[model samples]
Target: MNLVLIAMIAAMLIPMYEAWKDDNIWQKMLALASISSKAGIMTLFISVLRDDWMIGVVGAIILTVGNAGLMLLAHVIKRLDDL
Candidate 1:
């Protein structure tokens, strides 16, 4: 794997792991990671590339919300089936 890629992944995940290890840091790490995951990729290409980081940030937000909604929907469906 590329070193730069590894570095980026580390930057994004290291804080998250530290947060996971302790309750107080968990929320901050997760929130930062979630935002970073959405925005970080765009940052790599936005300057030399065509698209802006704003789109990437928006996509990330949608991804997180969509994933949570999917989980909730699945849980509700399972509950309905049980009834």
Candidate 2:
């Protein structure tokens, strides 16, 4: 379990690095989206390992709402860019 968490953390860092290194707005948003997804998955994995329903629910909410919010923000940014 520790090894799995370590691997997930390492995977999450890849996007963080990309977000840091890139200046493009779309790439940064994509990287942020990826990071959000990995964080939600990691949270759910920990919840399952501990057999906690509350944490699992929180993770599920993070997964859905976080991504949806990001998509909406991206759409708004796109519209603004076009104006």
Whole-model lDDT values for every prediction: 0.56, 0.91
The residue-by-residue lDDT of candidate 1 on 37-80, one tens digit each, is 54445354443354566765665565566546545655676678
Regions of model 1 farther than 4 Å from truth: 1-48
By summed lDDT, the worst window of 10 consecutive residues in model 2 runs over: 18-27
lDDT of each residue in 1-83, candidate 2, tens digit only: 89999999999999879878878778888888998999999999999999999999999999999988997898899899999
In model 2, residue pairs whose N, Cα or C atoms come closer than 3 Å (at least 3 residues apart or on different chains), thus clashing, are none
Q: How far is candidate 2 from the true structure (C-alpha RMSD, Å)?
A: 1.2
Model 1 local distance difference test score: 0.56
Positional deviation of residue 28's Cα in model 1 after best superposition, in angstroms: 32
Which candidate leads the pack in lDDT?
A: 2
User: How good is model 2 by TM-score?
Assistant: 0.90
